[model samples]
Target: MIPLSRNSAVFGLNIDPIGHHNGAWRHPLTQVSRAYDISYSLELSRMADAAGLDMVFIADGLSVNRYAPDSVVLGFEPLTLLSAVAVNTRNVGLVCTVSSTFTEPYNLARMMSSLDRISHGRAAWNVVTTANPNAALNFGPETLPDHDSRYERAAEFLDVATALWTGWQADAVVADKDRGMYFDPDRVAVTGHHGQFFTVEGPLNAPRSPQGKPVIVQAGASATGRDFAARYADIVYMVSQDLEDAKAYYQDIKRRARDHGRAESDILVIMSVRVLVEQHDNAAQERAAELAELVSAEATLKRVSSFIGVDLTRYALDDVLPPLPEADDIQGYRTQLALVRRLVQSGQVRTLRELATRLNGGQGVLSFTGDGRSVCDNLQLWFEEKAADGFMILPQQTQRDAENFVKFSLPVIRSKPFGRQRPEGATFRSRLFG
Candidate 1:
C-alpha cells in the first residue's frame, strides 16, 4: 500500500469541456466555440496547476453520447489530449480514461509508459470496461459483454498491463560508453501473459517510467466492480448521492481492500462533485436555477435511456420509474442503475423528469451550489466525516464557475487542517498517496 500523509486530502479537477451540467454549453458565459479547441483545455490545466490541485482528469467514451448533439462530445482522445497538457504543466497529474474491453493490454502499457516519460512521471490511467453498448458497435461487436464478464476482462487486462509495465527493472539501463553497454539485457524480462481475454508476450518496448508504473484508477461501484477495484486500483472515482451513501461506499471499498491483503490507504476514493460557486449565495442559487431551466427534457431522457439501457421516454414525465432488470442482465452501468432504482424505491425521487434533471449535473454526483465559503464548508464536512478522501470538482460553468472555485474556495480549503497544498517537485504518485 502506498503511504499517505495523515489528515491530508487529495483534490482533482474533472475537465469536461462543455461542463458537467447538461445546460452549461447554453449558459451565457460559456464559450461554445472553444469547447473543441486545445487552447481552452491548456488554459484550464494552467489554472488548475496554479491552484495546487493534485490532478486534471479527462473523461472519455468510445462514441459520442446519443442524447446530446455532436457539438457537446468530448472533442479530443484522452491520451492524445493529456499528452498535450503534460508538457504545458509542471506539477499537476494528467489522468485519462481508456477502456480495457476494446484496447490491447500491450498497447495500453506502451502508451501509458510513453506518456509517463513525456510528462516526467505524472500519468494516470482511469481503467473502464466501456459501459456504453454503442461502444461495441464502434469496435465491431454487436453487443457489449455482461457486467461481470466485462469486469472479468478488465481484471485480466490490468494483470497483463501491469506485467508489461514491470518488464524492465528500475536499473536496467546502464548507459556505459567504456564498456559499450547501453543496458543490462538480463534485467529486462518478457511478460508471457496468457489469459482468457488477452495473450500478450511483451517486454514492453518502452523502458520503465520515472514512477516505475503510472497510477491506476478505476470507477466501478457494483459488487464485481468493487472487488476488481480492491484488487487492482490505486484510486477510485465514485458517484454518491448523499453523505450516507458516500460513507457506505468508502467503508465498503476499504474493507474489501483489506480482505485482498492490501492496505486501505493505498486506494484513494474521490467522489465527484458539481460546484456552482458565486460571490453570494443568492447569485449561486439563481445561476443554478437558470442552468436547470435550460435543461432539455427530450435530450435528458435520451441520455438517461442510453445510460440505463432502457427507453425512459416511454414513461410519462410524471411517472416514477418501474422496477429494473437485475444487474446481471444489464449491459450498461449496473451500479448506477441500481442507485437510481434505490432512489425511486425510497420515494426520494418521484418522477422521470426529476431524475433527468438531477442527473443533468455530474450524472448523479453530489451537487453543491453556494458562495465560496459554503462550498469550502461542505467539502470540509465530507472530509471530516470520512465520507470521502477528497472530491473531483466538476464545474457547472467551465470558465466562470471553475475559475471562481479556484480563486476563492481553494484558499479556504487549503487553510483547513485536512486540506493540502502540493509540495514542490512532487510526482503525481507522491502527491496522490503522500
Candidate 2:
C-alpha cells in the first residue's frame, strides 16, 4: 500500500518523573510524598497508556540540586525508571534522556536496546547535550565544552552509536539450542569508528533492537541543533511561546529535513505544553494563580542568575536582566531566552523580577489553564498553524490535572483526524508518526 499522509500527531509528555514545576509537589492536593515512589510513576504511565498517548518521556541529567527555589528536583535515573514503567504499562512509548557529552555511546546503545527488548519496541532515546556546568564538572571537566564543540562531538557520538546499534543484523538472535549456538557470528559486524571525538570498536553486545535502532529524539533548538535533528532525529522536542513562531519553526525543520534528503513526515515536531486543569475553568484559573503565587521573586532571581551564570543578587529589582555580554555564546537553552525576549517586547512584564516569575514556574514552555475544551481549542490552533506535529503535555500542580486531561482532553484528541495508527503492537515511531 502507498504510504499514508498525515498533518499532525499526538506527542508525549515530559514528566520530570519527579515533577515538572518547581512547586508542583507543594500543591496541597499533589501527592508530594509519592514523588519518589516507583508506583506513582507507573500509574502515570498507565494513565497515558489508557488514554492512548504516543509516549511518556522523562528528562535526566548527571548533576543535581541546581534548581530554582521552586524548581522540581529530578531524583530518579531516567532510563532505569522508564524501564520500571515499561513493565507496568501496556502500550505507551517510554522515553529517557541520556547526554551524549557524558556517556559512552556503546553503553548507552546497549542499555537502550535492552529497554526496547523489555518494552517490546516501545523505547526511545532523547539525546541531549546537558547544559548545567555542574554536570560538566561531574563528567570530569573543570570547564564546560563550548556549544559548538558539544554539538560537534554529539554529531559524531550519534554516528558511532547508531553504527554500533545497527551493526548487529536482524535475525542474528536465533536460539538454536540443537546447534548449541544462540546466534550467528556471520551476521555481526564491527563499527571501527575512529573520529575526532570518539573511538569505538565492534558491534554492540546487544542484538539489533526491535525498532531497528530505538527512535532518535532530539531537543536542541539552535541552528546547529536544528541541523542535527534534521540529520538524525525521528522526533524533535521543542518549546515555543506562540503559534506563529511554532509554525515558522515547523516549516524551517521540514525544509531542513528535505534538504538533508528526508521527507517532512520522517520527522515529528512536538512542543512542550503546560496544562492546568480543574473541575471548571474558574477553578483551573485559581489553581494557576496559586501556583504562580508560590514562586518567590527572590527565588526566581537566584534561579535565573544561576541559569544565565550571572548573579542578580546585588542588582536592583528594577534593573534589566544583566546584559548577556556573551548572550550568543550561551549554551543549552536558547528557547528560554527567546521567550524572555518576547515577554519583554510585549510589555507583559517589566523588570527581571517579573520575568523570573513568568519563567521560573514552568520551564518556559507554552502555559495554558482551562477546562478541556479551552485546552483543545488552543491545541487545535497550534496544530492548524503547522506549529506542531503534537505536544509534550506537562500538567501543572498534580496528577489530578494529568488525570483530567486523560478523562477530558485525550478523548477529544483521539477523535481528531491527525496522527497515525498502526497494528496493535507496532513500534513507538509507527504509533507516533505512522
Candidate 3:
C-alpha cells in the first residue's frame, strides 16, 4: 500500500497477447481465442494497474512481416489501443511505440500530444526508427535507408515534433465560459521552423497535456543510436543479458547524458528481463521445461537468422555458427546482434540449436526463473550493481503465466527492502525522472 522507497528498482510490463515465446499459444491455459479482442488487452492492463506496476508498454512495427515470430503477434495499433485502454485504467502509465522513420513529424506529434491529454498525463512514447528491411516497401521506398542515414533523419524529426509540443505555453488556455472565449491568442505562438527532414509552419493544434508532454522512451543500441538517446530520451530500454555488458552500457549512457548537458539521473536505463516464476523453484523449472519442449529447432533458427541478417539454413543445427558480422556492421536490432555474438564467442552455446533456443526468450535478455523471492533477489543484485536503474518485464509463454507474474512475484517484491510494489510518481515522466 505504501510507495516504494527511494532506492527500490522500478518495473514495467511489455504485454504479449499470447506470450513472448514462439510456442506460447500451444500452452493449454492460454485463451488463444481471446488474444485478439480489445477486452483481452484491457484485462492485461487492468492486471498491471491492479498489481501496481509503473507502466504497461505496447510495442508496434510498421511491417507485419517484420519479426514475424508465429506465436506472438501484436493485435492492435499501439496508439489506438492505448487510447481505448486510457479511459479504462486509472493508474498505470500507457506507453506505445511510434516510428520516427516513416511518420511525418507534425502528425506523430499531434497524436502523441492528444494521447497524453486523453490519458491525463500518464503517456509515454517508445520512439523508434524501425529496422525492418521489409518496412521500406510499405512506405514507397525500395529499401530502408542506411542505419546512420535513418538516425540522422530521426534527429531532425524529434526536434521538429518537440518544438510543436511546446508551442503553446502551459497557461495558454483560458476558458471563459461567460464570454465564450476558448483560448487566449497571445499565449500561443507559431513554431516557425525549417529542417532537413520536415518543415512545419506553426504551433500544434492541441494544447499541452497535464504532464507537459509525453515522456520520451527509446531503444537503440548502435553508436549513433546511443548518442541520439543520450540527447533526448528520458528512458532507454536495453536488451543486455550479461552484467558486465549492462554496466558498461549504463555508464556510457550516463556519461553521454552529461556530455549533452543533462544530469546523470536525467536518463533512466531499463533492462529488459524474462520472468518465469512459481510457488517453488522446482515448479518454475518444470514450467520452463514444458515451454522448452514445445520449441521447434528449425523455426527458432529461421527467426534467429532474420534477426542477425544471416542465412543459417545451410548449416545443421548441431554445427558451430559460421563467423557472424561484427556488431558495428549489423544492420538490424543491434541489441540482438550483440547477444548473438556474445553467446557464440563465449562458447555459451556450442551449436546453432543451442543459440536459437537461447534466443527464444525475448531475444535472449536475462531470465529470472525461480520462486518469487529468488527472482527478486537476483533483480536486486542487478539494481545495486548499476546494471539497470529499472527493468522492463517480458511475460513468458502464456496469458496465465503473465498473470502469474503479478500474483506471485509482486508480493515478494513488496516485502523486500530493495523491491517496489507501485509506480513512484504521479505522472509518467515524474515517476521515471523524479
Q: Which predicted model would earn the best lDDT?
A: 1
**lDDT for each residue of candidate 1 in 56-156, tens digit (9 for 90 to 100):** 99988888655456337668999999999999999999998999999899899999999999999899999999888878998898988887888898889
Q: What ranking emerges by lDDT with the best candidate at the front? A: 1, 3, 2
Residue 367 shift from truth in candidate 3, angstroms: 1.7
Candidate 2: RMSD to truth: 2.8
Write down the RMSD of all candidates, one decimal each: 2.4, 2.8, 2.0
lDDT of 2 by residue, 1-434 (tens): 11233654666765554345666777777766676878878888887787667789887767666433355666689988998988888888988889998988889889999999899899999988877778887768898888888899999988988898888889998899999989998888889999998889878988887887888899767788889899899989878776667788888888999999999989988888888866589988887777767766766666666665567777877787665433355775665665555676767667877776677576577877788878877888888778888889887754777788777776666555653332345788777665
Report the CA-based lDDT of candidate 2 relative to the real structure.
0.77
- Looking at model 1, residue 356 earns an lDDT score of 80
lDDT of 3 at 371: 83
Regions of model 2 farther than 4 Å from truth: 1-5, 66-71, 175-181, 320-322, 325-327, 345-348, 418-425
Q: Which candidate, 1 or 2, has the higher TM-score?
A: 1
